[model samples]
Target chain A: MRISELSERSGLPVQTIKFYIREGLLPKGVNSAATRAEYDETHLERLRLIRALREAGDLPVAAIRRVITALEDPGIGLHDLFGTAAYAIGPRVEEPGDDPAWRAARREVDALLEELGWRVTEEAPARTVLAQAFVALRRLGFTPSPAALRPYAQAAAALAEHETGQLREDTTRAQALRMLAATVVYDQVLVALHRLAQEDASARRFGAS
Target chain B: MRISELSERSGLPVQTIKFYIREGLLPKGVNSAATRAEYDETHLERLRLIRALREAGDLPVAAIRRVITALEDPGIGLHDLFGTAAYAIGPRVEEPGDDPAWRAARREVDALLEELGWRVTEEAPARTVLAQAFVALRRLGFTPSPAALRPYAQAAAALAEHETGQLREDTTRAQALRMLAATVVYDQVLVALHRLAQEDASARRFGAS
Candidate 1:
């Protein structure tokens, strides 16, 4: 089909479609001339998946490219794909590790998490995220104290671990661990866990929870 | 006290304290001429809070600044202050009303939740995340197909909502309801529920069901 037909069917604008092509996100159809290109079902299907990961999964472009590449490779696990993407766009802003105060604050947060009896893992980008946040905020003139973060980080770490651990307790759907790894580790850490909190508050007396 | 003394007490480094003073993230302390700034417990408390928000909450500097400002305000509720920060960081990349694909994905995911007999919401930023992923990927070299996504989006929505609901149904975490809101949402959606499947699988294979 022509790009216009593809656009109408996909519900995306022609200009946007062109942007996708230019970004190298979309494959070019057989070209009869300089001005003409043909697209097929492969393009349509790929576009749909792109929309799904981008819109539903909240993946960034660079991350999305990595995910697509991984998905196409057939050898990579889904968990790895998600981990790369989750860390790719960067989480919040991180502080530079070169600074001593930032390092102190980072260590404090970790110590508190440990204090809470939650097993903290280095697997997720929590450390990276914290590091970058400091750097970004410092750039914007914000300083963090280890004292303020200790309890909060511990509490959050405990809660996050609790939430993640709930997976191990459920007695059904246990066989799907592989599928769950990518979906849960990435989604829960990146967005879903927080969403639960947001819903609670909106419903609270405050107005939106 | 000396910078090192303050560092020992506050658990921050002398250098970082200087950076904070320079960056204005921390207020300048009593100066011993132009050579030094003194910090006290108050500064330490403030710094701790800043780190917690940045690391555990993963809040952006701009958002963290707003939170700090609010935290310092006399009239704001403490609960509300934290709640608002969570909302500010939000789901997805957080630009509202700009991405069609994102919105559509949100609606689709919400619909998926509904189909799975779970209480679904329209306010989720998960959709936005998915949308951003699309835009991001399109910026790269791969355009995902809709057929590839429609089913997965639907399945994720259904599975997440259903799984979490089931987990909550059996437990009496009386506050699980509140737990759902005051924390991140996706964690429970993906993590807690996935645990159920894993648990059941473990039971079926490792022990007598």
Candidate 2:
């Protein structure tokens, strides 16, 4: 297909497709003439992945580039592929300063993880992310106890297990791409679901009419 | 207490505190002299809340302002106050255009919600948010089934129940503010925990060494 058809099929403007090619987000189409180029199914697939990551996962262009780079590496294992994509797109937590309160919060998070026996790396960004929430909660006069966070952790664990159960050892590139898309997009799904559940919980408690 | 003391107590820079006041996120202090103003415990508490919402919740200034405005309304019921803050600071979903794929995904999401019997408003932003994720996932070649989503919803409902259980009928202003802060900050907590759990799941499945 020509660039025009590619643009029409992808529902992206021709100028936007050209801009993506210019920005190295999409590979240049095969040159068919001096000014005309032909695109293929790969271009369409890539565009879909880019759109999903940008719109649903809310990943920045640079982060999407990192994920694409990881996906393109044929030698990368499934675990490493998922890890790279996750690290590229997951919410970031700024490193905490040496405040006693922040330190206490960090220790509490570490303790909670240990108590749960969750095998996350010591350098996992989620540790600091959890600690930051703890610090903020404590500042607002609610120090969330480990007991309080356990249900959330257990739920997360069960959900993660179910998600990973869908993965297979001998995955094709296309299948891997689909999984990668699911991995990022499902985060938004879980977030929305949690909010909806909160509304439901509130309705039950307060008598929604 | 002076502005500088408020800054010290809140641990926010003096300029940032002034900026917050200018932005109407924080109320102005009492005028004491030609160029100086005296702040009190209210200012300190507001500063803490603002910092938590900004840093932990990642809410923009305008959203924080809306939350603060809602919080300041003395006659607002607890449920209404929570709804206001949630609408103000929750992740926003862009309304979809009249695309068939989007409509299909939206219908599927509506069905899932109905099947779950979750009592959410028709206009809940989370509905659109969930539909968007479903659309993105489908574009990437994974149609998430309602059965697959049930466990996630159940987990979210249980967690929401535990969280709402912390609220009381005769809450103080401080407690309400704390709950508001919790409402925003715990979203980040759940996200981080989910990612950490994913890491653990990946490690177990792929044999992380």
Best by DockQ: 2
Q: Write the per-residue lDDT of candidate 1 for residues A144-204, one digit (tens) a residue.
A: 3454333334333333333334344442221122222233323433344234433433334
What DockQ, on C-alphas, does every prediction get? Answer: 0.07, 0.48
Model 2: share of native contacts present?
0.76
Over 4 Å off, model 2: A1-77, A94-108, A168-177, B1-76
* Ten contiguous residues minimizing lDDT sum, candidate 1 chain B: B172-181
Error of 1 at B141 (Å): 21
TM-score of chain B of each: 0.48, 0.80
TM-score for model 2? 0.72
Q: Each model's fnat?
A: 0.01, 0.76
TM per candidate comes to 0.40, 0.72
